[model samples]
Target: MDKINLLVTISIIIIFIALFLSLFLLTVKTAHKLSNRLFAFFLVLTAIDISANLGDLLAISLNMRIFISSFFFLQLPTFYLYVLSVCYSDFKLKRKHLIHGVTFLIANLVLLPRFYAVDEDSKISFLANIKSMPEIQFNHVLMHIQMLFYLVAAFMILRKARKIYLENYAGASIESLNWLFQFTVALSAFYFIALVKNIFKFTEYPNISAGLKIGLVLFELIIIFWYLYKALNNPGLFRTIDSKLKLVQDIILEEKNSNQFTINEKEHSEELLKLQHYMMEEKPFLSSSLTIQDISVAIEIPVRDLSLLINHTLEQHFYDFVNAYRIESAMDILKDSTKSKLTILEILYDVGFNSKSSFNTAFKKHTGYTPTYYRKML
Candidate 1:
């Protein structure tokens, strides 16, 4: 067709492909299957909603076009549920949650008789009339109202979840799914703008609605592709929230971020001793992903002060300080007669070193000999 229609058609095709890829990767590759499955369901609802628009653009038959309005009300609930799945560790799509989609179901049921009554020739007329019906008009208004409510609710959940996560384990390498937050914000803005424009018919231009639809299609395509790229690269992006850790981390982050604490030199040395005692007792270095931030949180010292003590007082960088403990731990494992059956790789992993090369390098740096050589000598 024309350039505008061509762009819409291309965007539709790209979105379809992107949706398939996203669903496939999210279902197969992700760690937390439940959350990813929920996300995939959201994408499916989005695809159905967009497909209805594409059907209108293609002048698809009345049978296909008549039901397009029925799918419109499901988008917000699906999105909100998806957000719930990601942010809550124990979220389950219970029967009660299906109440959110009750309006969609009722709307579709009410239209079913009309859908069958309209023939192919009169389908467009039927669709036009359906839109004008008092009930349908009410539903249309209600859809936007529902959208506004759910948008706010979903954002509140996400913001709270993210805040909790950062407070507890700012140093953890867990995927935060911040993209979903951005997506929801963008979607809310797009829908709000569309609602306002439609209500006011703000444009004098005859074709502005078509242009807006095309622009929305383009924006959705961008979001879909970005989602696909991230899903493929980071399969664990939708993993379940660590609620317990988040709670604890929030407490720690609050304490750390607070400005009320101070330390004199004597207290600094005392805190340093406490750090040493905790390190020796807890051996948090056994976690490969441990960070100075994690340590600082655990020790209840400011990260800056902890870094100063490790780097200046102990004459070691944070990484070196942690690795020094890991290497030492590995040596103990190697030297222990009862642990003689453990493999070098196993020993390395046990002490929190993720790779053999790093373990070997650290071991050699500390002991002036390779692990295997040291073990053999022992």
Candidate 2:
């Protein structure tokens, strides 16, 4: 097929896949209903945005084109909201979120006077002179600025959420968090390339612009397929953190500044000993879904104190702290001659690691060898 036909065919497939994913997200029976809905909406917006690629082939009218293009304003904001929803379990669709659509409203207002309110002949004339229109220029600039802002904000949220996950949850949760982080990074890279493509569009090099556009479509196609593979392989990929949870560092800083919380050296040592005893004797780390709050309750320590003890005094994240014990337990099993028949998978699950990949990673990090290599040496 010709280049235009190939591009159009790819765009059509992307739209179909995007819509299919959106429908699946909307209807999927998941704990993160709100997050799924937000993401579904974002996907729908994406499909609409991609539909613009078909304008010429479909003989799309100017008004219809304008309507479809207007959704561009909502796309990134919806994505931003989806990021927020994924990060925070308590996230809800608040009335204040409507403010995100202000740019869309403004874009429509800008078009009203020049294009939308005019007749077909006038609209075509306006389109011919669109490059010189200040309104079009302003909207283009605004769109780019909004994309930059939302992409940055989404990244910051993901970074903070990952840190919080490390400080509060166990190692098993890392895979899901890493998946989300990868998704955000991929989207960010896509947006950056799209920005570059937009810049090239105004340059004299039409061929370069077209090449970038094709590359973007191909990049997007890969992302969707990768997402599908991940989603199908790991049905429980999404995990949420309580929005009210504070970072351990933030808690420590606040306590130090306000002098509202203090622990003497003796008390700190006592708590550390207590935590260690419980971890050793009770083996609380055996629970794959363990959290710092669970440890606090089991050891009769305050959550804040537990956070401070493991995250601050021990100089280790709660995740690493728990995983350390689990790794130790797995090591003991590996060393035992009586348990020679126990497979690495069996040992991993017995020691609270739900995923073999996480177990292998933690074991290798702790022992400088993969579980298989470590076992073979013995």
Candidate 3:
């Protein structure tokens, strides 16, 4: 009815909508089934928490209120496990995971008579006389401590995961987890603010406490909306850990192969010759976005074999190896007097260099002179 209540109600409603959409998106949009399922269940728990908060605000029935509040202890652990799921490629929900539900069970048992068995009016009276009960204050303190522990643990998981990712993949892309990290950090800030607000509750500066509480709610609402926008646009954000692990494995295998000679050196050498022939004839590198994977497929060689041939045998990275052929082609075009009328840009384009700067740089690197200077010398 009042502005403050209206604001709170609106924010809660938005959070509800976000939870629902996030659940649906996590299940239907994302391909990472295991992690997605875990995250979806986490959202379900969060929705239950929000429902409990709504029930309390609306002064709902005592039994229903206590049932919802019992879920409070389950939220942090579920979320902490979700972060682990996101990080570890082999993560699975084991039997030991039920330990996380212990607090919820205990909370429900302890609240059996205090809140759950009471009538609606008596429940409201109990909430009003909360200061008379030290147990409620203790529960709040324990919840804050649990929340802080999991927040730090989640960060540690991500930090370790990031290190593993970089060590395994030479060209590893962190784009998928980058937004997730932002959301995690924002959520941590929300928890920190709530903790501080509770600590300074009875202080003279009530405005600071009120402002932080309000800020935390607003922070949550804004992030949920941002998440919705990101989810819609970047459905690949939750790619399977298996897929990520496979990529890392491929890179590591390639690197290892580069260190040792293949047993079938004759066959591999033949393949390398064929690969060079294929590149010269096919000119796949002309495509600006060419990757080792693409060339490997075209040349009918395993990506690791191709990487080994290029890096160890030829002593060049894939990009440089391809660019060398492109430069050689450009040189041929430059030396051909029949194409004297063609502009240097035209020659670069015809030879498959995508941009002028790239053409100039590659030309200089290979030829010791810029395209214009080389053409002038001719």
C-alpha positional error of residue 1 in candidate 3 after TM-score superposition, expressed in Å: 6.1
- Residue 81 C-alpha lDDT in model 2: 91
> Considering summed lDDT, which 10 consecutive residues are worst modelled in model 3?
165-174
Please provide, for model 1 over 1-378, each residue's C-alpha lDDT reduced to its tens digit, 9 standing for 90 to 100: 585577658667865775886569465844567766776776776777777656545666665554665676787887788787777777777889979988787776665655546566565566566546665666667777888889999988887776544443322223444667887878887787677546544346536666666676777777777777876765545544554433433443565689634436897689889988988999998986676678888888986567556655665656667777888888889889999999999998888876676678778999999999999998
- If scored against the real structure, what TM-score would every candidate get? 0.62, 0.96, 0.61
Alpha-carbon lDDT, every model: 0.70, 0.87, 0.68
Query: Worst lDDT window (10 residues) for model 1?
Result: 166-175
Can you write out model 2's per-residue Cα lDDT over 160-189, one digit (the tens) per residue?
998898889995557877887788889889
Question: Cα-based RMSD of the predictions, in order?
Answer: 10.3, 1.5, 8.3
Judged by whole-model lDDT over C-alpha atoms, candidate 3 comes out at: 0.68
lDDT of 3 by residue, 1-378 (tens): 354675568557765775787668565844466666776676666666655435336675566776776676887788888777766667888999999887778767666677767777877787787655565776677778788888888887776565444332222124445556787888888788878987766466777876776666677677667867876776655542332433334555675689854357898779888987888788876665566667778878886666656765666655567678878888888889998889988877776655576578778999899989998999
Deviation in Å, model 2, residue 253 alpha carbon: 1.9
Instruction: Give the C-alpha lDDT of model 1.
Output: 0.70
Candidate 3 local lDDT, residue 32: 62
Which residue runs does candidate 3 get wrong by more than 4 Å?
Answer: 26-29, 52-59, 117-125, 170-173, 202-211, 240-378
How large an RMSD does model 1 have?
Answer: 10.3
